[model samples]
Target: MLRYYGVDLLDHHRGTLSARRVWVLLKHLPRDSAFARELHGEESAWGLGEHLLASVIDHLAIGNWLFTSAHTAEGESPPDPPVPVPRPGVADEEDETPAASAGEQDLAWFFADL
Candidate 1:
């Protein structure tokens, strides 16, 4: 499951970012507290909605296992929304373009390599 399905990663990063995006997020995380924070961010956000996915991840506990103070006591507002566009991945899966013809596969063009 860890290899095939990264649920924790998915939970915190489903819409706002892909696995590659997450590496960027991980880069921005406090280096000292990255591991525990990133893991905590992922685990704590289980079952959260897709829209809120990024925020929950932004609150990662860090590698040092420290908690993020949502309210900094300085009256800071909640973080802003993520960019609307999605990153690249598996585009062909969603592609409505027609597949090659049956004969195409059987033709010299298809078998050229084989």
Candidate 2:
């Protein structure tokens, strides 16, 4: 069953920083190790709850940027390099935001097309 869910990405700094800290923590601690378990319970330190931590770990791993040996007791495998996810991408020029309407006369608006 999926464990982590409902992670708040609001308060941009806190959320993103917390995720980065967790990633670093995972790099040092083996998955499901005692240290990880302790930190997961201590929400203040990790800045996330149990489910949120699990969700963050899952997303990073799915993107192949994080690895965990939690599934096995031996911790036999080494961490794998991140694998790029195949994405349906749009050309940058095509994806640009539509230019502002002509009536807006702000400096940014004047430069919008440029």
Candidate 3:
């Protein structure tokens, strides 16, 4: 692979032969920015470091292993059904939606525009 790229991958980093290369090498890879970045871990793994393992999964396109385009909720609820009963001596408060931060609201609007 380095020969094709006109550089020795071994020399790219010194004293490292473990070769933490991502899966799905140049084979059948389209020359698209998204595909390249996903393989390179640029905008992936939530920007956390130590993502060499994740880059492999992203390159392989494994549905269960890679990130999906599904709408997933991060919060978890109680396993049992809710028991609608107020606590003793508790007063009913007015319901109100939490105010989102400006950054959060801006990101939401940006994605909505996209």
For this target, which candidate reaches the highest lDDT against the unseen true structure?
2
TM-score to native of every candidate shown: 0.19, 0.16, 0.14
Score each candidate by Cα lDDT: 0.40, 0.42, 0.38
The TM-score that candidate 1 achieves is 0.19
Task: Give the poorly placed runs of model 2, Cα more than 4 Å off.
Answer: 1-48, 65-114
Candidate 3 residues lying further than 4 Å off, grouped into runs, are 1-4, 15-114
Enumerate residue pairs that collide in model 2.
4-51
Candidate 3: the clashing residue pairs are none
Each prediction's number of clashing residue pairs: 7, 1, 0
lDDT of 3 by residue, 1-114 (tens): 453444354542554432333122333334333444344333322333335555554555544323343334457332332233322222457645333334433334423422
Question: Which of the numbered candidates is closest to the native, going by highest TM-score?
Answer: 1
Q: Local error of candidate 2 at 88, Å?
A: 35
lDDT of 2 by residue, 39-101 (tens): 343222332365566666667866554334445347467466544332222124448643433
Q: Candidate 2, TM-score vs. the true structure?
A: 0.16
How much is 77 displaced in model 2, in angstroms?
A: 18
Per-residue lDDT of candidate 1, residues 39-95 (tens digit):
343332233364365444544423112323454455765444433323222134467
Residue range with the least summed lDDT across 10 consecutive positions in model 2: 83-92
Cα-based RMSD of the predictions, in order?
20.2, 20.2, 20.1
Q: Best to worst by TM-score, what's the order?
A: 1, 2, 3
